[model samples]
Target: MSTQPAAERETVLIRSARDVTELVNSGAARGSHAKMIVLLALGGIFLDAYDLTSLAYGITQIREEFGLSPAGAGAVTASISVGAILGAWLGGVLVDRLGRYRVFMADMLFFVVSAIGCALAPNAEVLIVFRFLMGIGVGMDIPVAMAFLAEFSRLRGKGSKGSRTASWSPAWYVATSGCYLVILALYFLLPDSQHDLLWRFTVGFGAVPAIVILLVRNKYMNESPSWAANQGDLERAARILRDSYGVDAVVAEDAERPKRESKPRASLHQFRTLFARRFRPRTFQALAVALAQTFSYNAVAYGLPIIIASLLGQGDLNTISASLVLNLVFAVTGGLLGMRLANSAGAWRMTFWGFAVQLTALVVLAVIGDPSSTAWVLLALFALGGFMFAQGGGPGANFMNFASLSYPTELRGTGIGFNQGTLRVGSTLSLFFFPVLSASFGTGVFWVIAAAPLLGMVALLAKRWEPVGYDADAVEHEYQQRLATPEPARG
Candidate 1:
């Protein structure tokens, strides 16, 4: 190695992965490239939310078309959740092993192909198969999307990592609302004779955005600089910083390579690391939040039209209008407010309060039973709107915050993957049972839904871990420090 001056090297060189991480953490990079990356990642999330909600209004139509029993309808509805369970579990590991760029690109094709297949399916069995494939696409996108959001942002202040991660909430609601708008448009535009094609058109439209995102992703998407550095590829990390973050980082030729973690490529052992002593509390909280949030959110959001129609004894047009208003006004608004407050109020507090509000809303709905009058119907609507508002702003947004922020870059994918995979189990159960439960129990199903947020509140009280404003990359910094310090000589 040529003898470079130590002082000069200190000033100009990125000596370790920690150096790159520090540059990112300091919020030095202010470039359009960074913003583009975040927008693209949000696009992926938008696709996930859109695809999931596309069939919400069409589920009854699908049942009628196929002459399906309740159990058969549940199967068709729950198929995606089943597929998502596998996708999240496997995708989480793959994103870590393969890098976010590769996995993200690959998952988009899943959306396109699955959407087309679902649109063309001739039978109920075939439709279920395509929906399962769509679920996989949805499941795979989340971990990678969350990774891109967290890695691209700074640790604190406005548009901080926490706030950026929470932005997924608004993106999701916006997409859900977008789905309803599409359905509403089709409701009026399609001829009466072609009304049977509504479900097909709605399901197929999901592919259009997926195709658009896929085309643009290649030009703008770059490997996460932190993920590049974590893999001991300082040269690649430096290039990414220069291109994406507007930082001209220099990697000295003679610098020692940053030590990589000994963790094996995505496996059960890798999953075990999430529950190791240091990460156990975080993992528990993440699972609790995800399980509670998804169980309730899926049940309520998927069944929104049914709930509205049942409450008001309204026709399809009225149900669609009510659902759209609830999503746009309450859900989307709450999500935006949550993102704004994430930096100041903290995720733990917001999530806890969100669960408390949802718990109360569900309890009120349970107490009210079925609405017999217009005023009672408004009260029921208010309760449902309250639950959506709380969910959008609180737990729905912050669950990803917990999954993505609680772990260092090395384990971020696996932590999010494990958490998401477990949560999908709850999602599957809720989707499969919600219709059955509502049919069997009538308005009493609200009491059952109340249990989800109550469980979340209990877990939050039990293990209080706040991921907001915490520096996950500090572990890397500490590791670099330990390496720099000389070992004590043997006595």
Candidate 2:
């Protein structure tokens, strides 16, 4: 059942267009299949999303349970990001070195472990520790999954079916919304006095998707041939094609070509190579886009529950649930819009316009919102939420499109890992600092948060290059030509 290398494993060099075409055609098969993978892969993120929103849900309870203050709850909440930082740093290296299919399956183990730990935590200290570990797993999954989605979509084709599968990411937003709904359901079903189990069940239910994925993963998951070929593993590459597409068999001679003898794989150095001249500009672009998306998206969406909860001044669970549902709806709407635009408009263009829209929304939010007094604040929040989807979700929709296009096939995964790793760092920083900034600065702090999208707009404007609808080779060739030209000698 397994194609484990026996004795000495040989790399298969794929030289035929026929094989590559077949490989891609097979991948694009069912419009819904990619969605299934997205749901499965994003299972880890669903937990992260649920846990993140639920922290707000569970925070009130935790504060009471631990006899703590707001600062203590903030500390517990931020710890997950610290853990995610560690996970993001290392997860990229591990995923790049290991096959995507294998890592895809194995990484879930971390999520499972952390979930159990979170559910069983005995003290505030212990809860924070477990939550951080779970965050690490969550942080690592996004880049890998995005790479998988992009590659799978490209192999499948960039058409309706491909679009359908790619759009599965919005399902995560839906799933995340369901998480809050679950909390509301549990609140009504369970006795008010039996609140102890609420957080446990909310966090625990996150594992169900992973378990379902585990069962189906073996049957459907195949190592990406393009990824294997990039790693210089031709035999493994061919085997993947044989297993997955069945139509793209490499010829024996090409399949048996001698593998290149290269330097020992340096995951760390490869990680840094992302910022080298060849990759640096786009690396920064990808990072900025991700940062803009994350900062704006997290600031507005995650903060929505906090804002609504705080503003309503002693609202029922239903209000909190409604706020979360609204966040999910607008977020999914943005993601769907991004999916529509991904193929036609450039990712950077979508990013620029999205951020521009977001900036406008945030400005309106700052001008009109009186967190304490204004009912109009909710209207701004909804528009801001919808605008945010385009900003982050648009670029977030296409980080892989840019990353995959920027680097050569051989370094695609490494490039993606490093790029994503950088974004995760930014995300962690944003998550950690936003609350502090908000507390010290007040609701008007959104004005400061508003600056992030502007920065994204500046970065996008200064470095804009259209990458959509082009093959990797053509994009690389253009970059090489641009790099080879001698810059005018400085005076």
Count of backbone clashes for each model?
0, 5
- Per-residue accuracy of model 2 over 232-316 as CA lDDT, tens digit each: 6666666655565443345456343434455236376787777777678887887777677677666666566555565434365
Compared with the true structure, the alpha-carbon lDDT of candidate 1 equals: 0.87
**Best prediction by TM-score:** 1
User: Model 1, which residues run further than 4 Å from truth?
Assistant: 1-12, 258-263, 476-491
Candidate 2 backbone collisions, by pair: 11-234, 11-235, 12-234, 12-235, 28-156
Residue 485's lDDT in candidate 2: 95
Cα shift from native, residue 201, model 2 (Å): 1.7
Instruction: Please list the residue runs of candidate 2 whose C-alpha ends up more than 4 Å from where it truly belongs after superposition.
Output: 1-39, 42-48, 155-169, 254-256, 260-266, 312-314, 371-377, 391-393, 473-491
* Estimated TM-score for each candidate: 0.94, 0.84
